[model samples]
Target: MSRKGLGLLVVCLMALCQPLPSRAAGPLITPEEAALPPPKGAVGVDRRGVTRGPKIELVSGSDIASLPTRFQLKFQTFGGATVDLASVKVLYLRTPNVDLTERLKTFLQPAGIDMPDASLPPGEHMLRVDLKDSDGRAGSTSFILKVAR
Candidate 1:
């Protein structure tokens, strides 16, 4: 082959060998975590005031999801109160109710959770997200994600 042609081939090969960008660094919910049994009191109670409180809304294409799926949530507040982003907490509704706040900190935002790519094991999984508003009124929401094998 000519030197020019060989160089071009080598460049193409190098580009092909480069690693592709990952959707997510790691699974949002590991297999073991998903396998855990439900906690004794896994129910999340809303502490929102009768008059007004913050609201959490799940915004996704479907409840049935696949691995590395887009997970988006929108927050709304009542009585002119704004969401207190720092008070956000995420819990995996399983035995002992796993705290996923730290793991999902990167995806949590002032608006709400906006994870472009979140991975979870197959089966049904539940998540409880809670947050407070500037007025100290609390709001919580439960989300069930069903994944296929």
Candidate 2:
């Protein structure tokens, strides 16, 4: 096999066999990230420690009124997969003139952490996040977050 192809195969094997580092051994979201409502759908964490991904779901109780003006949304991928933040595309639609894609990338790239929503409108929003790892592995999730006013 070509060196590049062989290398990818090695990566794939490592990804399948290796456990995530200790840092990722916890819940996808800590209790403090955002006050998520009860989990509505089934819960399972993928190789990336992502329990909520590949699809979108609003945090159960998050509504316009109770939605915090400030919050964090984190992203990660395991199985030896790493994403390029700039290449990590996002689509924040259904709201007025605002594109959060760049903002989200900015949030993850600097500290290598979650995206922060410090100031957001209180209403229903459709947010989509698509991540492609450096190895070409991809995962995405889209969900609605409603802020009650």
Candidate 3:
């Protein structure tokens, strides 16, 4: 190619290669701005301090109670992440004619307490469960059971 043509080509290339000035940085977000709580139903936050996604519903158990036989209260978190079941406390409320302490001892075993097995007479009872997760988040639920002879 001719020297003039090469020079023109070089000039055009240089012009094309020149970098455009970068846009000014976006407005700075202070800690106060980032400290805003997640919107209702938001599960978590993103690295850019925006809401990540929707809140996840946790499944504790299907049958929280059963017959006079042994039963278990299982739980699990859905969608977001699995949370550990740290501790569970069962509050057994006795009916007007039933023994509170004795019956509770039998019903809330296997979880943590140790009690001797005994037949419970017909009566109404209130079972309140307090569950704490590994992250220190706590939740509670209740159940009513009637034992018939």
lDDT of each: 0.79, 0.48, 0.38
CA lDDT of 64 in candidate 3? Answer: 24
Greater lDDT among 1 and 3 belongs to 1
- Candidates 1 and 2, the one with greater lDDT: 1
Clash pairs for candidate 1: none
Off by over 4 Å in 3: 1-68, 78-86, 94-119
Which residue pairs show backbone clashes in model 2? Answer: 37-61, 48-78, 56-142, 56-143, 63-147, 63-148, 64-147, 64-148, 65-148
TM-score per model over all chains: 0.73, 0.48, 0.35
The whole-model C-alpha lDDT of candidate 1 against the native structure comes to: 0.79
TM-score of 3: 0.35
Cα deviation in Å at residue 112, candidate 1?
0.7
**Local accuracy of candidate 1 as per-residue lDDT tens digits, 1-149:** 99999999999999999998543535778999988897675543544446577888879744654567887889888777888988999888997678888877777777887888787888877888889999998888886777877
- Model 3 residue 70 CA deviation in Å: 2.8
* Candidate 2: C-alpha lDDT: 0.48
Q: Rank the candidates by TM-score, best first.
A: 1, 2, 3
